[model samples]
Target: MSLTSTEKCAAAEELIAGGKLEDAEFLLEQVLDSHPLNVTALNAKCGLLMRSGKMAEAKRLLQIASDIAPEDPVVLTNLANVALLENRIGDAIDSLEQAHGARPDYLAAILLLGQVHQMLGQRKEAAEWLTRASALQAEDPDVLAAGAAFELDQQNIVEARRLYEKAVETRPDHIRSLAGLARIRCLAGDFDKAVELAKKAHLLAPQDPESALVLAQVFFQSGALGDADKLIGRFKRRYADYAPIVLLGAEIRIAQGEVQQGLADVAAWFRKAPGDAARLVAFLKLLGKAGDWQRILDMCEKLPAEVRASDAVVSLQEEALLALGRTKEGWQSWARRRNLSGESPCPPVQVTLPPRAPLLDEMVLMRFVDAVARNGRLEVSGETQIPGMWERLSAAASVDWAREAAPDPQLLADLAARATLHAPENGGFRAYLAPEPGRRAMWEAALPSDGRPRVGVFWDARPPGLLIDHLQDALQDLNIHIISLQFDESRHQLRTWRGVLDAGVKLEGPGDLVNLVDCLDLVVGPDGVPLHVAGALGRRGIALLQENHEWYWAGSDRQSIWYPDVERIVLPIGPSWAGAKPALRETLERIVPALHLPVTT
Candidate 1:
């Protein structure tokens, strides 16, 4: 009944596939002890060691396997795996390339190369490799799923969905295809179908880490907290701390108001084994939530050299350093953001936004300060009213601003290929954008009676990073008249305001906003377009920076080089808005009384 070394190695592969690492290890050892140079035995043993978290041992054994069969593609790929585990990205890539070179048609090497190239932001190489893989194994469900996953990561949802559909049709039992489709559904907000797909994936691989994590996330986000909790309990210790399951458990707990305990759990997990990208992002956000800037900085030092350079971590660090008075280092760190790879899914499209990039109108407004720049025309088409300074910007930036709800994609592509786009981060310097005379006159007619200083408030209702839900409560006890300067989709939330004039509805564009801001005693909001506009116009304002902050307003001594006149208030860690209210009152008491002027004539 005894098995040969080859037979034992075959059985060991089955055990590893079943997640029975100990049994797999025993079988591999028996074969390895007799046939020390057996490649199959060594490869299977490496797999078992890696699964058991013995990366060093796995790597050492792989070196021996390489010597035994120097050109073996499988051994070369395992070498890549070990390098990846240690975060040695360059070495991993070299190994993969060598494997592919040795055997260009090696399907395993091709698929892995496609995945790794995508992870490293090598989109051209990834596309090439993926195309090759598809050509080689067009009907294989696994190949179809891998292609879909790569496309999904690049945010090509339609292409990914098409591939996933083909994959499921080819083989409905493929676990990865099911899970990939589930995630796409979740992103599309079809939570019911997402739950169904995730459940099928989990049922197919009840003990698999990825399947469990995906199901748990779908359940949690869809408000099936009880199911998520039970799933977490089932796999809590079965998966390691570095797996996203740990972060998922802590996230569920934090969402339920167990902030302290949830933070502690993540802290311990990150301290022990810290370099998974998703885990690091969540951990750093929680650290900021707890106001632990020093530890966040400390994490930068403790991280693997490759991970420390990630755009996400570095961006967050820039914000932390700015908040901590390390201006020199913060800006230097932030400057690196413009070119970092592998972090962003793709580079910003190269082109001039004539109507210009709408969301970045504030940045564009700053660039229009130069007289020579004002000589161009910008053509833009949109459903909403033309933004303030539309005509002026075309004159300033050489753009022709237009009005169209739907623009032709071909026209945009042609314009972008040759258009000159402008950026406002010009050495932190800017010229003031003056309010249009007519809009200023209209705003003057709507000014409040002279007495209790009028302050325009813009707490974004969408709450990307700032949301003070109790704006009414904060203003109900103050002496100031709160004008609703909020705009866009967030303007509708002002219906509940008592005795407030909804002036946000009146804004025509950035120029209109400038006119309103120019007339107010003070403008108050989180760091946003309004605050950015206020600073550009040399107006007084209070900018509330919460735990999750952007580096756009990075300046030392609570001053932004871009908005030096505005009072910068960094909200202390913790999600509560209790601290912001006090700062608001103090800034108003000190500044509003010093200037009692009427709306600008």
Candidate 2:
């Protein structure tokens, strides 16, 4: 007569929430042993399994629970959770809708529906669903916290602060609300108040990792890297199994310039929990940051098929392949770049973009805009959010950016069809862009008549200063004239050098730059605009790829398929540029000799 099965099940749910998984399993088993088909016991056990990185097993239990009670709100909600854990986002929404239909007053399903819609960037729908939930349960702290989180994600600070304030008033001990309010204060640049609120939350629940994480993040953001590191170290000892704590600690260490240690921590976490999508994503991202693309590809091949095929992992794998010069395969997988960033709008739940097309991709839309302008007049049916972009486009071309409030289905369809940039073998036109006639004439007049080779040097974006220094040194001694086409602060480096003309000093735009590139025998460095312009014009050039080279330069070892006239010199990845000297010399010997002007290595 100690307790009924229902009471035990309820106790088990509390245990699961408290991180007492072993005790929860014991209680669930006791209830299940007495009643094998008990949905509550099954759901409770499944939650424990899922928390421990056993998604497949948890799904089996959830399926059994669902079969027994098809219309049970908890069962359907748990089913949605299982789908979410496995990255089946569409299936998750379907289950959530079913859960809400089964029990119209179920708060969890309503909040989850709102959360999922927001994750997909469907703000209007998310607001409507969250509004319904808030209207029904105004006093519930959970409901208020959910509303606050959605507002905070979109930077609606006023609304978010109000909701967080209300939630905190309802339950002062609520760690999530406290942490959220602290974040809002931090975003407002009120560091002192952020620290006070976070510290209060941490003191109330010392074991709660969310409180600790918010405090550490606040410290990190406030330029207190040392304090953040110390706090993270303290939290890591007690909350080693907590995913957010581990990730946040690693992030703090990285901010402190302890990147090697941070990478080790994330890599170790992945080794221990490869099933965790967040761990995999963190590991790959850190590896990329360290310019270790080779290691990423190696790790991907070793992982289990399920883990390898994860949306996050696959995106990184494609990036690694592209960085390592695997072009054809990378471009074949290029349409999935939208999935490269798996956005998690909510904590502990991975929300990803759908792999299908017709999403509002501004990058592709811009490309279309550019193409339309070059050809004739353009019609921009959909609205754009980029400041001053439409005005600029309208200035350049006869564009109508004043029609529909949202993107037409036709615009999305066009974006989907024209996503790929690769020129299919024997089909699409490969070279069409050319320099403006007047600008090209100006650059031609600016060139010297000394009969020496014209070399245009530009190191934009990730400027390898030392590498460019060495390259220019070798070129100056040779029978060639150097022209500095670098328009940014990097152009200052060439000021002291004598007899070097500055063509990019006051250029108007890319058109002027393209004309400068047209005058040079070679245009060099990690520049996207100049390189593509030179390639389109069938110009010969030497490309110095960056630590993380873009996908267009993929699968190119000796020469580019996109521009066979240009040769690729893949610069070594990482901070040190010393190793690239010998590689650069070899490329110079191979390509420069053909310039036919008495070149000696």
Name the top lDDT candidate: 1
CA error at residue 562 for candidate 1, angstroms? 2.8
Give lDDT tens digits, candidate 2, residues 392-483: 33224444454443332224323322323322321222443456678678879878757777877666322222334655655656567778
Root-mean-square deviation of Cα positions for candidate 2 versus the true structure, in angstroms: 11.9
In order, the Cα lDDT scores of the candidates are: 0.67, 0.66
**Estimated TM-score for each candidate:** 0.59, 0.52
lDDT of 2: 0.66
Candidate 1 lDDT over 62-130, as tens digits, reads: 989999997898898888777655545667788889999999988878888887788666889888998
Q: Which stretches of candidate 1 lie over 4 Å from their true place?
A: 1-109, 121-125, 137-236, 241-431, 434-453, 460-465, 485-496, 503-519, 555-558, 595-601
Give all candidate RMSDs, comma-separated.
Answer: 9.5, 11.9
